[model samples]
Target: MQFVIRKLSPNDRLSIVTFSDDAQRLCHLRSMTQASKAHLEDLVDGLGVINMTNMEAGLKTGHQILDGRHSNHKVHEHT
Candidate 1:
């Protein structure tokens, strides 16, 4: 797993993080605080990692459901 993080602005406390899988596919994009040491630590900890994995799975499932609904809609339109 790899992540790329960049500050939204020089004077801002927000940053954008791009999380990539082993194959270099972008799996997740998120905004986080740049000034919170505890939050940052939690993100790298074991529990946080597990939570992130679960969230990723949920996100993928959501996309699949949305795609199915979109495809169904297209079919109904053609009928």
Candidate 2:
């Protein structure tokens, strides 16, 4: 839940920069208007959420793998 506000006075200016990707996708802002900026910010926030979810899922999977290995080790020792 972050807010972004960009205000450029008549004298102020802005520039946009982008790099080429393997997919040959062109990424550029459609406009510098308030609504566009808000939309872009929302997209960024969504990406953050997705990234965190992936990280948490990975951690859980790792823990499960480790627990399985440890359990197998203990059972072998008892036998």
* Clashes (N, CA, C under 3 Å) per candidate: 0, 0
**lDDT to native, each model:** 0.31, 0.33
lDDT of 2: 0.33
How many clashes would you count in candidate 1?
0
17-78 in candidate 2: lDDT tens per residue?
11111011112324456665665555545432221123333333334344442121111111
The digit string of per-residue lDDT tens for model 1 on 1-79 reads 1132343433433221222221111222224445443344444442223212233534443454444421211111110
Query: In candidate 1, which residue ranges exceed 4 Å CA deviation?
Result: 1-30, 36-38, 48-79
Report model 2's TM-score to 2 decimal places: 0.29
Model 1 scores worst on lDDT over the 10 consecutive residues at 70-79
Off by over 4 Å in 2: 1-28, 49-79
Candidate with top lDDT is 2
TM-score of each: 0.21, 0.29
